[model samples]
Target: MEFDKNFKTHSFRATFITDLLKEVPIHIAKDIVGHEVVSSTEIYYRSSLTKKDSLKILNSVDTLRFN
Candidate 1:
């Protein structure tokens, strides 16, 4: 048997997931990536929550508190 050059593999899936995470919301990403459910996308493709992201949230809260 021969494999096609366009065949999907684990590394391709990983790259797709990473791009989706960077570009789209969970629900949209799920659909584009062919996940049956949002939970699956959330479980599989979610990026690590970062301190910079947290800091942005905290700054928004701080601004709200002062207004």
Candidate 2:
């Protein structure tokens, strides 16, 4: 709730944006942050990776395969 004034904004912003986009829907995040609309959240956040990036990681894991 409370953060020091000298705390690194870039690190905090990166963590906040990553968690916002990669974990939950924009609307839900907007609500959590008291934004009136999902677009407000989207304007400030973006994903570092696409769905294809996630699929590539999943494919590379090789923990399971269809027989």
Candidate 3:
């Protein structure tokens, strides 16, 4: 597939880190990227998530079952 002209190598890094944040802890992602602060990593991290993404996450939560 042809990539958008604006896409760059750093874009791949951002995408990779963003996907990692979805499945893993933020601290883990911070260490992986060697960021001095989680907030620094968060700048890239937060932008990746969308409203639909938030809904998907919320929907994935299993409702409490009464025993």
Candidate 4:
């Protein structure tokens, strides 16, 4: 059996950290990834929200009804 040419064990580290960031706080993600500094982890995840996306979220929030 052979793996893909680009398959490096460490290649998924960035994606792992990025997905982890989506589910956990930055400090937690940093600790999970074993980075001594948060700055090193900061470059891995991006929120990337556009103006339209923000407005969509705001509109969705407006639809919430509390009893």
Largest lDDT belongs to which candidate?
A: 4
Candidate 4 global CA lDDT score: 0.81
Weakest 10 consecutive residues of candidate 4 by summed lDDT: 58-67
Name the lDDT value of residue 17 in candidate 4. Answer: 81
Model 4 lDDT at residue 46: 58
Model 3 C-alpha RMSD vs. true structure (Å) is 4.5
TM-score of each: 0.55, 0.48, 0.58, 0.56
The number of clashing residue pairs in model 4 is: 0
Q: Which regions of candidate 3 are displaced past 4 Å?
A: 1-4, 46-67
Which sections of candidate 4 miss by over 4 Å? Answer: 46-67
> What are the per-residue Cα lDDT tens digits for candidate 2 across 1-67?
9988888876675568658767787778888777798766776674677899989988877656632
C-alpha lDDT values of all predictions: 0.79, 0.73, 0.80, 0.81
TM-score of 1: 0.55
Is candidate 1 or 4 superior in TM-score?
4
**Weakest 10 consecutive residues of candidate 2 by summed lDDT:** 58-67
Error of 2 at 25 (Å): 1.5
Q: Please list the residue runs of candidate 1 whose C-alpha ends up more than 4 Å from where it truly belongs after superposition.
A: 1-15
lDDT (Cα, 0-100) at 16 in candidate 2? 85
* Position 8, candidate 2: lDDT: 86
